[model samples]
Target: MRHLISIAAFIATCAVLVWVFLPDPVPVETAPITRGDVTVRVEAEGEARVREVVVISAPITGLLQRVTLHPGDAVTAGQVLAQIGPVTPALLDSRARAVAESTAAAAAAAVELARSQLVQAEASLTFARAEADRTRALFERAALSQRMLDDAVLAERTAEATLASARANLAVREKELDSAKAMLNGDYAEDTACCIHVTSPVTGRILGVRTEDEQVLQAGTPIMEVGDLQDLEIMVSVLSREAVNIAEGAEATITGWGGPDLAARVERVEPGATTKISALGIEEQRVEVRLSLLAPAPPALGHGFRVTARITIDMAQNILRVPVSALFRSKGDWAVYSVEDGKAALQIVSLGRRNDEFAEVLDGLTEGATVIVHPADTVENGSAVEEKPLIGG
Candidate 1:
């Protein structure tokens, strides 16, 4: 009995020692929960591009004899922006003299031909009338042979045909004379006008100039460019995955371009995607999206300027919101660890209208309630934790 008592005492002593020397659980640092409005935004970086750019090119090939206007020169439609090589005085004088001589010669020849044809037609007509009278007189008196009267009638018909032919010839000569006169007038030589008068097609400033004085340009070469700065737009390219969610008339906010945030609306989403090689050498499908500013853009903004855009895909007013980092997948449901007296208490949450950084808290949490952000896996119901201040809090 004494030995049994000693064994029990020894076991009791061991149990007490084990309980007294056990290590305490380690404490975890947690971010403090704050209450404020949280907005979820989708951010994209892109360059600004003009909505409409007009490229002015030479209509025909010639020496760029003059480029009187420089870039930023305001011009008007039909204004002579530049002039090509001018025609030499000697050439012009020779062409004029040749035309005058040719025209005079054609006129003299035409007049002579017309007079001769008119005289022939008149003579033939007189002869035909006299012959017809004689034929009638013979036929009536019966003093002439019938064959002679028939022959006289045939002669009169022949004379009439001759007169008609002569009149037709005169008409042909008149048309020929007009053609000859036109040729002698040197209308074709007026093509030299192409050497001068390069006019502006639209009233705007010159954006580019490709040629200087006396430079020869090929056909269809662009000599200058013009664009209306008042008409401006923002063109942004987005990944195909992101583009699918974007649609026309979506609201967007533009910022980080050296001005106040500007409101913009999506005008169009391009249908096709272009393949672009990323820095990793992976091909990405990108689609262009066009946005129009609802308010006037600052004058300082120019083409190809880089800016940040936040597209509001979803939004809700007066809805409970929580930091996105607080969300965790628990048993196939989104959950957060609510802090109560510096202890984590597991709570299931229903979310709605989630943005990039914040999520709308639809249920399970109230406003001004403290929730643990970035909860650890070891965190559980009734877990002891200490709330620490968040960065930038």
Candidate 2:
């Protein structure tokens, strides 16, 4: 019995020694390689804009009346938006006033000359008509030659044409005299009836008004902007490199504009690149990409609103994928520490595409295989490892 007790004590001592010398298993968080769809997307901030924005400008240089229409006001084609009237004449100096008076006098004299010419023409026409009638009567009776009768008719027609020309001259001279007199008298009264009405050329809501107060404006000055809210689209500026990958008609999603996620499609990617200063004070070449909302946008969505855009550049289905956190560079190649048989196995992986959360595993990984996520520096190949429970799981 004593000998048996000694042997048991020796065996227990040997077991304790082996247990003390053994290395502890390294705790690691792991996830199984998944076979699912992986989408590669590019994200950027964007703005909602009207696809077609129309600017209404002043048609003539004049005194612009106060605009009654406000932003967001519904407008119809040919609806009167504002009115413009002739500007009040400036106060003229003595010399200028005298010159204007002389011009008025000259215009009046021209009108009188035209009127006298008209009277003389009418009198001549009457005399020629009587002579032509007599000549025609003589020709009919074979008492006068056809040539003489033709001369009389020609004179009568010429006199009638001269009378008509004189009347036209008189009317033109009278208008010139009236214009000169108006300038001399400075008689531009402020009347809405005489104002030129500015009308909207489209049926839509007003986007913006340049000014609401009455002021003098030159012709072609923009007064307001109009656009259809229903035709809203998004404009996003992305890095030139990323822009090259985004194809026209690619699917996208929009968010962060005080609404639910909205579906959209890439309408176009601008060919030209623009230099932009980034928030970090870095100069970046960016290209503008246009996106069209697939569905009717919310009623609140309007021009110049902010939005977040995520454009899918590539996609793969039924492929092997793993969390991006598990990936790390090893010897200038993509690698991950995959857990196998309670040990960490280093894998040099061939990757295809990646996004914020996941990466496509082209090779060196299989579905249902567990990989250590965010492995520590101490982790290495063939190292003993144990799965760590997730917090709150």
List TM-score per model, in order.
Answer: 0.59, 0.73
The CA lDDT of each predicted structure is: 0.74, 0.92
Q: Candidate 1 lDDT, tens digit per residue, 34-69? A: 444555555777767556666666666666776777
Off by over 4 Å in 2: 1-24, 93-184, 187-193, 389-393
Model 2 TM: 0.73
The local distance difference test score of model 2 is: 0.92
Flag regions of model 1 displaced more than 4 Å. Answer: 1-41, 66-70, 86-194, 210-214, 328-333, 346-348, 374-383, 389-393
User: In candidate 1, which residue pairs get closer than 3 Å at backbone N, Cα or C atoms, i.e. clash?
Assistant: none
Q: Could you give the C-alpha RMSD of every candidate to the true structure, in order shown? A: 8.0, 6.9
Top candidate, metric TM-score: 2
